[model samples]
Every structure is written in C-alpha cells, then in structure tokens.
Target: MSAGRHGRHEPVYRALELIANGLVRAQRLDLHVTGLENIPDTGGAVLCVNHTGYVDFLPLALGVQRAGRRTRFLIKSEVMDIGIMRFLVNHTRTVPVDRSRGAEAYRAALGRLREGYIVAVYPEATISRSFELKEFKSGAVRMAAEAGVPIIPAIVWGAHRQWTKGGARNMGRSRLPVHVRYGLPFTPGPDESPERETLRLRETMNSMLLEVQDSYGPHPPGEFWVPSRLGGAAPTPQEAAVIEADEALRKAEARAKRAADRARSRGSRR
Candidate 1:
C-alpha cells in the first residue's frame, strides 16, 4: 500500500500515547529527535531499530509519532504472555511472535503492513547489554521484501543510561538525554539476498548509531551505559555474547527443572 492510505489510529493507541507522553514529561526526559521526515507520512514500512535498552522503543515511537505515524512493534510472545502486557498488546494491535511459531507472527506483521500500518522491528531481537549494535536478523529484510515496503533504519542512543541489564535503574527525574534518528528508507531489490540486505541494513544503522553517539556528546569514563570502545565500562561485544549464552543456559535449565517437578507432582497424584 502506498503512503497516505492507512486508516485512522485506534482509540486505545491514542490513549496510550497520551499516557506515555505524560510519563515522558513527568520524568523530564530530554528527547532529541531528528530525520522524522524520512518516515513516510502514512504508509506501510518496516522500521528497523537497533536495541540498546529496555525503553528504547518509547523514544523511537515518540519520534515516529512526531512524523504523524503510529508504529506496531513486533514483540516476543513471552512478553505477550503477561496478563497486563497481553491486554495492552491486544488493545494496541501489536503483533506477537512466538519463537516456536514465528511464521504466525510473520504473517500477522505482513498483513498489517499490507493494510498500510508502520511496523517497527528490532533487528537485534533483544536489548544490547553491551550497549553496542548486535548482529542483525534477516527477518526484517525478508518481511519488507514480501510486504513490498521500504526498510527505515533508525537508531536510539543514550537510553541505556536510564535502565539496562545489570545496571541500576533511574526512572526518576534525572533529566537524561535520549537521541533518536531516522535514516532515509530503502527497499531491497527483488534479486537481493535477505542476508546481504540484512547486513547492509545493520551497517547503515551502525553508522547512524555512531553518528548519534558522537553528537550525543562525550561518555563518562568507566560508566556502565557506554561501550568500552567509547571509554565507558560496558562489556565488549564478545564478552556480552558469553554473558548472553550463560543466561540462555540458565533459563533452559530452569525450564527443565520446572518440567521435571511438574511430572513428579503428577506421578505422586496418580
């Protein structure tokens, strides 16, 4: 679908936006948004964002809203399983991807795109504990290709300072500055491989992220929010990979223990 063809925004989404804006104001966040014009006024587009922190989506969505477009984010099914989150996601029309059944979510996102809704996806798939760009997944490029929509590269910087993994949370009125930038949209060629397109998209967003960081000012030495290369104490990407791997192993073990306990309980009952 072309630009300027989408339907009106849902009432719940509008209401949530108001609450979110109020929260932003309450926290006195110093938000800097640029290149919003790159977001199509009204059209189906895949917004590929680099994830740095838990609240990265908020600032990025605010920037897109400034462009007069509401974004439907592709969220994980685990988050959707939460009672409150489930209600919010359902009411706001967000698409949920079950990792075990990813195709279902892909179809849902594609349908939304074809219906002319801007779909935001984090190609990194998770928050970067290292505060650096993680490797990109080809799903965003593949979705854009199938949906015939442009891929909009976006970057969010400085959000990790507020709240991040293994870091102290400061959701209070700290007056933190978060920067959001939107790069020009581009569509992959029909013959281009998804892997190649995904790599190019990552490179583009990485460059944009560096630019945002540069303009965002100097990083405090040994701070947890900045990447090690930039002089802060955040772990290097390689170290972060190990940490994430350990985390995954722990989660798997916990799940197995739970399953075994459930089985034993059932046997005792029998």
Candidate 2:
C-alpha cells in the first residue's frame, strides 16, 4: 500500500471504507486498473475522474485505496442531504457542494488539500449522458493551481454498463467489466491561466480515455450504456444535445399550460 502523507484514519471512516470496499469486492465485477505507479505514495493531489454513472466513484476510490491513500470527493449537495448518505459522506470527510456555488466548493477542497488530503473532483460536473467525455469546467484546474497540488487524471469506463444516467434495467448481467486508469500527475505553471490549463487537462483526459477504450476491445452489443464507438446504444454529443433540448421544450410547455390553467380559474372566480 502506498503511504499517504496525511490520510484520515478516523475509526468511523475506516469502518465505512472497509464495508463499502467489501461491497464493491462482493459484486465480483471485473476491474482492470493501470497506472497505479503514477500515484504519488505520499502527497496531497487533486484526482480528477470522468463520471459515467452512479457507481463510478467507488471503482476510483477502490483504486486509490489500493495505492494506500484515501480520497475525499467533492460530492453533490443533494447526496449530502440524504440520511444514510449524509452520515457516510460526513465520516468519509467528503466535501459537499451546491452545484451552483462552485467557489464555495473550491474553497472547501482547497482546505482539504492544504491539510495533505487527496480531493477528487468530477470536472465534467455531471454524468455524461452521451457516454463520452464532455467539455470540462475549470474548477479542477483552478483548485489544483490554488492548492499547489498536481492534478491526477483518472479515467473510468464500463461502469456505465452496470448503471447509467439514461437507464440500467440490464444491471442483472452476470458479469460487468469496468476499467480504471490513473495518469501521471502534472502541475500547472504559476503564470498559466486556468482556462489554458483546463483545456490541457481535458485533452490529456480524452486521450487517456481513448486509450482505455481501445485496449478494452469492443463493448458488447445490446448494452445501451456503452459508448457509440464501442458499438453500443449510447448517444453521441449531438444526439444528446437534441434530446436535452426536446426535454426542455416539453417541460416549458407543461409549465406554460399550468400557468394558463391557473389564470383561467382566477378569471372564472372574478
């Protein structure tokens, strides 16, 4: 196990880690991990992972644990509000972020990094409905730069097969394969702008993801969660854009109808 410079060792956190990691192992999911050596044995670093599904975070956490470190994730504030999830995340020392207030989240993450803890951020901000890397926001790069820690790009593919934002009715499959790969950490120059660094980070992550997919061979058929390149039913970015637009239009129409109905009721009363 790689030694962490200042990993958390609270009894409760350790207990939960054991249980959650045990659950992951019990799933008997096929997990292939690479670039384990790229993780520094001891230091505070920003771990930037591409989110694909509900269970994507676990695989990355397991890999980080295997490297002898603990990761505190910048998680959605909604999850922090759930009863059991709140308890678990609090014990895990995770940072909860109101998605709209990114600055607050960055400050919290910066505090963790200054304390020599690894902070994980999903730069894409959400699960990519298209099942491919999307444009990254600048938060991760900014956090790394401000904290003076290197950004470690970790890519996970195949977890979407088990569960994804679109659908997961096929999760009962006997065997699911998940690939997790970490990359060499790099620091942004002090003089470099966060925008440029973000672009570089995105490119690095995309290239690494492509390599992961190619090496994993073809994704099986009838799997809607798999990316299009792997011959699955996942949507492309353009397709996803149209789907989102249509959904938004439907929602707008619903809201307008409700408003009209309320207005008609008021007029009838008068």
Candidate 3:
C-alpha cells in the first residue's frame, strides 16, 4: 500500500479510529482491501463510495486509514442530533448534512476538500436494500469539480451481512469477510457536464462493486444479504425503490402528525 503524508491529526479522531479498528479486529472481519496506493498521500480528494449497509462506512474508512488518511464522511444531520453521535461527529470533524438545507453541507464539504481533507460521500444517498448500486446523485462529482480535486471511487461488499436495513444484526463472531476496492482517482474535466460525469462515476463504482461481489465467493441462494440477481433472496432494485418510497412517505406523515400535536398542545396552554 502506498502511503500519503499524514494530514493534521485530531486527537479525538485518532482515538476513535483506534477504538473502531480494535472492534474490527476483535470481530475478526476478514477484510480484503485493494488499491490503497490510489489514495493520494497529501492533497484534497472526494471519495465517492457505494452504500450497501449501515456499517459500510466502517470498512471503507478502515481502508482509507490504511492509506495514511482519515475520511470526513458526509453524514446526515439527523445522526448528529443523537447525544453520543453529536459528540463523536463534532470531534471527528464530520460534515453534517441537513438534507433540507443540503447546499450548506455541499459548501462545507467543498471547503473541507479545498483544505486538503478527504471528503467521503455516498453518491447513492441511502443504503440499497437490493444490495445493488442505486441512482447516483451529482453532488459528489460537482463537489470534486468545484473544489478542483480528484474523485476516488470505492466500494465495500459483505458489510450488509453484519447489519443492514431489514436484516437481522449479527453481532456474534461471524467473522464475515468484507471486500473493499478503491479505483484509481480521476479528475473531472473542466468542461465535463456534471450529469454525464456522475453517470460515469456510478458506472465505474457499479462495475467495481460487482467485481468484488463475484470474487468474494459464491453468494448462497435465497440468502437475505445477497442481491436477487446473484441468486440471493434480497429485493430487486425496483422492489427496494418502492419499499423506500413507502418508508419515506410514512416518516413524512409521522413528522407532520407530531408537528400538529405540538401546535395543539401549545394552543391549549395559551
């Protein structure tokens, strides 16, 4: 693995990295990481990653840390609202993205990249229940272009087996094998359209993802963590999309109900 110059260290970040890595080791996750040399040792870059499960970031960050760099992942602001999470996110200098005010998060990420930090982004925005690449958002490519940095595409496979949406958590000593692959970094051309570039990025990551899945071993038939196309019983992309839409609508209605209840309570007191 090629090493890059270490960026400025945050005591808290380093401590957390050690703890997380310790947990990973204890779990004995059979991690196979490749292409660490692709990560530049010293400058800014946007690390675009494919999201498969909730713990996907852990393995991806592990690989980045191996390259002598820490990742500032673009996490949703709601996660920052949690008590312990808030402290962790703040001290680790994670970029909190309020989806309702995404522009602010985008600008913050751009600033970090310009400051020579590796800003990691999940272009899919959410975990794919189908275990397949979802539609890509242009934000990652746009940020790289605007910040004048390279885009490094990365993929983590087999994380979903440990914990994922709609899947049972296996905190046991399953010793699952996780595969991480980082493709060579590339800079977007000044005149390239963001949409076109975003599509290319998605395609590249998708190809890498499939390659990792294929080489990871035979995906068992009817297994919950494997994609349906590969013989597992996981939802297809279309089925997962519908499930996600329903989940979103349900959450929106719940939020609206809570707002109305709060307003009623306030009026009664007045």
In terms of TM-score, which candidate is strongest? Answer: 3
Cα lDDT tens digits, model 3, 1-270, are 112355445778878888889989888999999999999988899999988888889999999989888888898899876899999888876899998899999999998888888989999999999989999999999999999999999989988899999999986678999999999899988899999999999989988987888789979898999899988889999999999999999999999999999999999999
Whose lDDT is greatest here? Answer: 3
lDDT of 3 at 190: 85
Task: Give a tens-digit lDDT track for model 2, residues 1-270.
Answer: 122743455777677678866676677678898998988877689999998888898889878878877888887788876899998877767899985797787788898888788899888887788878888999888888988889999999878777776785434533667899999899988899999999999999999999998888677775787777667788888887688678779979998999999999999999
Candidate 3 lDDT trough over 10 residues, lowest sum: 1-10
Worst 10 residues of 1 by lDDT: 1-10
lDDT of 2 at 222: 56
In terms of lDDT, the poorest run of 10 residues in model 2 is 1-10
Cα lDDT computed for each candidate against the true fold: 0.88, 0.83, 0.89
lDDT string, candidate 1, 18-114, tens digits: 8889989999999999998899877689999988778889998988878778889998889866899999998876999988899999999999889
RMSD of 1: 2.0
Ranking by TM-score: 3, 1, 2
